[model samples]
Every structure is written in structure tokens, then in C-alpha cells.
Target: MNKIRIGVLSTARIGRTKVIPGMQRAKRCEVTAICSRNEEAARRAAEELNIPKAYGSYAKLLADPDIDAVYIPLPNHLHVEWTLKAMAKGKHVLCEKPMGLNDGEVNRLINATALDPGVKVMEAFMYRFHPQWVETKRLVDQGAIGKPTSIQSFFSYFNADPDNIRNKADMGGGGLMDIGCYQVSLSRLLFNAQPRRAFGWMDKDPEFGTDRTFSGMLDFGGRLSTFTCSTQLAPYQRVNVLGEKGRIEIIIPFNAPPDAPTEILLQQNGETRTITFDACDQYTLQADAFAEAVLEDKPVPISIMDTFANQHTVDALFKSAQSDHWENC
Candidate 1:
């Protein structure tokens, strides 16, 4: 079988630490080129990652005939721009999540892909690829959850630096965009419905004009999901699912180490059952799936529906926060 030749669009932390390494370990992906706005950084990353070539600009790397795919770990705002650029060059694109800053941006992105037949575009969502979630989703759909009632989740970390992109309102910064987004995405995954109304409160830094904390509720049909996403809170990441039958809690749900055991605590009729996935690196699994999708000419099992739903909910919440009341999503 031929390998999928992938170009690294940026040497960002995700590329250097998680994505590049995962691609190297996957069966069907080859890291052909890495590019950076800074030539020195690109050269350094190419050397460290053992990639064959380095380019000083993303445009240069995209023009390389050997690159069949491009992995974009760019900022939230740059996602649409480069994904379109890559697709225009006849390369498939795997972008980091949020897809884009808002629904409009994602719509524009999909519009750009309409003209291409050989290429495809997808947003990287490693959590859904992990066996834990696949099993959880199966159980939920199998009536283990028994008509989901309400959900509570959070992704919080203190990024004390006010100047960081995560804290800048202009650059799509905030707790909501950073950690909070995961909660919203996972909630939709559990509820499997688009939220109709949203209400939220955000605490902003007067000096920076960006939010330090965000707490919100999404009304998905009859199920209401509450989320706390903040950059000021002490480090905590978890997901809790509630149903008519019982409840469950996932600790360190998003980024568990490969082969690291993950617990799924379930409660029903005052009796508790604990299950564990022995160990899995969701990132590696995610990379492998993307490669298979390209090589097999198959559609990804996970769809853009939930990704778009999450983006819609998040966009409404921000608008509601600005309006100081509930907003129709």
C-alpha cells in the first residue's frame, strides 16, 4: 500500500509534541515536509522530527508535489484560511478543532471544498476516535444511559498570562474557546441534539478585553447541559453524564496517556460498576483513522454535524453573554 505523504503546516506545540509523533507512529502516514513562518524554527523542527524537508513558508510546502495531505495546527483564526489554501493546492486537510471561529467561517470552508473532488477536509477530534468514547457512545445509544436527562462537564486551566492568545478577545481567545469548547463538544456528542437556547456569564479582564471565565447552559431539546469553562480556575478536566437510569463520571477524560487506564464509573439502582480502557493514546488513534480515511476513500465515522452543533452553541453563548440574557441558538 502507498503511504499518505503529509506536510506539517506549522511547528507549533501540538505539531511538535502530539501530532507529528502520532503520525510517525501510524501505519499509513509519512511526514514529508514541515514548514514554519520562521525558517530557523522550521529547520529545527525538521531535524528533530526527522522530516525530509523544511520550508520557510506554508505556501512553499503546499506547492510541493510530494505532499498529499496537510496537517494544520494553526490558531483558531488561521484554520479556515490555510485549509482553503491547502485544498486549492489539491491536498487533503486535517485541521485542529473548532473547525473555524464560527458557523459562517465553517460554511465558507465547506464552500471552498465543493470545487475539489480528489481532496477532503476534516477537523481533528482525537477524543471521539478513542475506544473509551466509542464504547461510551455505544452504551448510550444502546439504552445504557436510558434517555439522557442532563449533562455536567468542564475543562479548566489557569493560563495566568493575560497577553497569551488564549486571553485575547481579538484573536479568538477566552476560556470558552480554549478549554470550554471541549465541554460543549462532548455535551453535544452525548445529547446528540442541537441546542435551541443559550445563556452564559463571562468575567472579562478590563485591561485585555478578553474573558477569564465562562459558565453557560445549553438547552438541547429537553436535556439541559451545564458547563464551566475558565482560564482562572485551578486545573480540572472532567465529564459527567446523567440519565434516567443512573450517572457516570470521567476523570482526565480528554488527554490520557497512551495505554493509560481510564475509569468509567457507572451507577444504577444504588449499585456501582467501574470499567476501564486498559490504555490508549487518542491522538495516535485519531491520526491512524485520518490516514485510513484517505487511503480507503471512506467517509469518517464521526461527522461534521456535532462539530458544527458545538460551534453554533458556542457562538450563541458568546452572543447571549454580550446581550446579558438567553439567546436563541
Candidate 2:
């Protein structure tokens, strides 16, 4: 395949505003179609994005023989459903993060993928594709920060609209599901170890039954990772990694803007150094990477197995908060 002919599974805000534009700029992919439950909405999105085709239903989009792959930005609850559907139709899938609500559902998708060995599947953790994170791993591996010891990450934004899908518990709404997942995944990536024990403290909105704010810790043997995520705080994000000899600080860790330069700070041996990176769209990089994997028959950079492990940690954090005790992952 010269370029992956992609179809978007939904006209979600992120799809139209970020991922589609990123796909357009990516070298090995083109978004050929878009789908929405409402025909007018799908038409509007297709027109705005300059996509060649639009379908009123997701099923129709999946059935399009021209679409070699599908980008799913549906709600969290619908992720597993449509991913399985798309894969069953022989289309490779790039589903949004937190692929399933729990381990059982995640396992189902894993099994489904196993039956279709030729199709590539990946969770859309765009940050993992960013050069900033690539440098972070290099610094750790090169021992620029000595033996890594801990990580602290924070992500938050105020959004309390009752009608918003993110505020609905049944739709997989919560601070952890929305943004804390980033912390859980990042800590594991930086440490290169699975956390054995987890603990959490959260405050739920009584009216919504969704966690509005949460703080959690993961014990990776002697090394510890702690994070606080909120859907009701002023918008802010950062990640700090401390080691025996020094520390690294990422100013805009999770949601770095695509059009602006980014940087990370390293402090060691009584001196500090700053590393800078040019602006690049992580979403575009993610699309291109997945396309290359599909075209060249290489394993996806962010494997579904990694997402399974991340969700396992997420489940432990939720269990810990409810039981008020440490839980093993």
C-alpha cells in the first residue's frame, strides 16, 4: 500500500480538530472517509476536512472497501465495540487510549486481534511518539540522571458540564480515565518496570458519580511514582523524574502544542541543562508510524499488550481508591 487509505470512525471533536489534520500532514496516510450518526454532521465534517467521502453510520464506513484502516475516536465505552467490528472487517485499527473500561473487555479485544493476525492494532497514545519523550528515555538510558528513582506527573483541566460525555460515569468518565491514564502509562514507560502495588485517594462528584479529582501512587519496587489528576482544576500539566544523582522536568508533558517549541530541564551535579525540541505534531507522527507498521508488517510501536498493562494499572488504582488500601497490579 503506497498510503493507508484511512476512514475515521467518528466525527468526535478530537478527530476533526487534531487527528484528521495530523493525518493530512502525515506522509503515509490519507483520511479518505468520515462517519457520524447524523448525516448532516458527517457531511459538515467531510466538507471541513476535505475528505472525499462521508457515511451516515459507522457500519457503512467499515464496509467501505476503499478504506484500508480506521481511526477510532469514539467514546471510551464504544472503543472496544468498534475496534472489534473494524478488525472483523479486516481493517487495521488505531483506537483512542484506555481502549477498554476494564481488563475483561480489554482481553476480549486482545483475543479478537489474535484471530486476525494480519491486522495491526494500537492504542492512540500520541505523546509516546513525541520527540520530547524519546529524549527523556534516552537521558535515562544513558544515565544522564543516574539510577532513576521516581516520577511525578500532573494533568488537569476544569470541565463540569453535566451534559458532557466526560462527566458521565456510564460513559467511562473520571479524572483517571480522562488524563490520569497518561500518568500511569508515562511512569511505567520511564521506569521500564511494572508497579507491584498501587494506592489511590479520589473525590467523586456526588451528582455525576464520576471522579472529579484523584491522587494515586504506584510502587515500582524501591522506586515510587505519584500523580494527581483533576477535571476541575485550572489547566496545567508537568512531569518530573528524579534519580539518585539528578532530576528531569518536562514543562508541558502531556498536551504540548503542535505549533510551539518544547523543552525539558535536567539538573544534576550542582548544574542544570535545558534540552529543546522543535515543534512537531505527535498525532501526525503517530499516524505515520502506524501506517509504516501496517505497510511494512512491523509490530506497532505502541503495542496492544502495552495498553493491557496500562489498563491493569488503571484498574488497580480505582480498586485502591474504593478499598482505601494498596492493591497489586
Candidate 3:
């Protein structure tokens, strides 16, 4: 059995806490290298994770011929620039989401990937790979919810640490880019098309210039989906898909660790049912799925085009928020 030699671009929180660990546990992946801006940090992370190599500069890591792929968990803004650079080096890329700051950036990425046939690029949306969502999609498609009409999603956390990357403005830190993108992307997954329009408002600090909270409505061909996201306030994360006949509700949406079996709350006419499923190791599953795509030459489950459309909606929301009027999404 051959192992996929994987190098991580940064010792960022997600990379350190999840991606690196997930890659280590994946049967198809062999953690080859880890890099960070600080040499000490890189060394420490490499030692702790038991990775073979560590580098101070991203350029050094990318230049290594032994590495077959790179997982990037850089800030939201650097996603495109760095992913393209890695792909240019003939390395497959798994970039952390909110693929880019906007639709134009995603298009730029699409153009870049056109040059690398063998070096495929994927957005790391671990939630999408989880069996809970898969089962929800199945139930919805099977009419577990009759004619899925709406989706209500929420993701929030109190970010008191203003120094965190999620609060940095130039890094494209904001509730929308960090968390709302999940809701928006999930909204697209609920159906097969992009939303026709989006209306939203965001709260931001004058000094920080990053959104603290955001709530919005996405009209996917008039189905009317709504989502709320925040980084500076609240303690909640849930997603509910409502149809005419019933609904499929997830009590815990994101960050469902190893044993978190998301209870699928199904409520129909007069009676309610709850299905407890085996917990999905989303991060590991995500790594395996990407490996399958790379190893077997199969299509990625989540489409890059879909990433483009999600950015389109996000770009439009920023526009609408700026103008205080409904805008094309």
C-alpha cells in the first residue's frame, strides 16, 4: 500500500488541531511535513504531531519533491493565492473553507486549476463529508421531508480573544466568511441550484472592521432559506431543514468531534421521531474522500463550481449589506 505524502502549509489552529491529526489517522495519508512562519513553532508542531519534517517558510515546504499534496489552513483571504501557488507546484491542495473572499477570487482559482490536470484542488468542508448530512440528504431525497421548503441554520461563538485570526480584518476575518459561509454552502447543498437572491445584515466593530455577527435570507428558487452566524456572541450551532410535511433537524452541526452522533430530529404530522446514528469522524472521512478522488481519479463529492457559486452569494451579500437593499446573489 502506498501512502499519500502530505505536507501542511501552516500550523494554524485548524491545521494543528484537526487537519494534521486527521491526515495522521487517514490510512491513505502519510504526514510528511509541517510548516509555519515561526521556526520554533514549526519545530514544536512537527515534534508534537510526529511529522517527519518541519520548515520555517512555506516556499521551502512546497519545493520538496517528496510531498505529493498540501493542506492549507491559512486565513480566509490567503486561501486562493496560496492554493494556486501550491497547485502550480504540481501538488494537490485541500484548502480550508470559505474558498476565497468572493466570487471573482474563486473564478481566478478556477482559471489556475485549469492548468493543473493532475493536481486537483478541493475546499475542506468537513461537515459535508459527515454521514449525518449524507443521511439527511438521503431522507430529504426520499421525501422524509416532503418537498423541502426551507432551511434554518445557525453557527455562533463568543470570540472574546480579539487577537484571534478570526477577528483580523486583513485576513478577511468576519462572522460571514468564517461561519456564515458554512450555512450558505449548506444551503446550496440542500438543493441542486444556486440561490436567486440574498438579503443580509452584518454587525462590525468600527475599529476592527470585521463582522461580529450576521443573519441572512437566501432564496433558492423561491424556497426561502435563512441562516444566522456570529463570532463575537452566542452559544449555538444547529441546522433545521423544513419541508411541507416534516423537517430534519440537527442538534449539533459543526465541530462534531469523534463520537458526536448528530441526532436527526424528524417531526411529521402528529408524531415525532429521532434517529441516533454512529458518529462520523468528519475530518478523517474528508481526508479519505479526497484521497479517493486523487487515487482513483474520481470526481470530488463537492464541486469547485459549487464553491464558486457560494462565493458569488457571499460577494452579493457584502454588496447588499453595503447598500441596505436586496441584491442579486
| Candidate 1, lDDT over the whole model | 0.83
How do the residues 199-305 of candidate 2 rate in per-residue lDDT, one tens digit apiece?
A: 99999999999999999999999999999999999999999999999999999998878999999999999899999999999999999999999999999998888
After TM-score superposition, the amount by which residue 57's alpha carbon in candidate 1 deviates from its true location, in angstroms, is 0.6
The most accurate candidate by TM-score is: 2
Better of 2 and 3 by TM-score: 2
In candidate 1, the residue pairs with backbone N, CA or C atoms under 3 Å apart (3 or more residues apart, or in different chains) clash, namely: 259-279, 259-280
**What Cα-based lDDT does every candidate model obtain?**
0.83, 0.94, 0.85
Clashes of 2: 0
Question: Which is superior by lDDT, 1 or 3?
Answer: 3
Ranked by TM-score, top first: 2, 3, 1
TM-score of each: 0.95, 0.99, 0.97
Clashes of each: 2, 0, 0
* Model 2 segments more than 4 A misplaced: none
Off by over 4 Å in 3: none
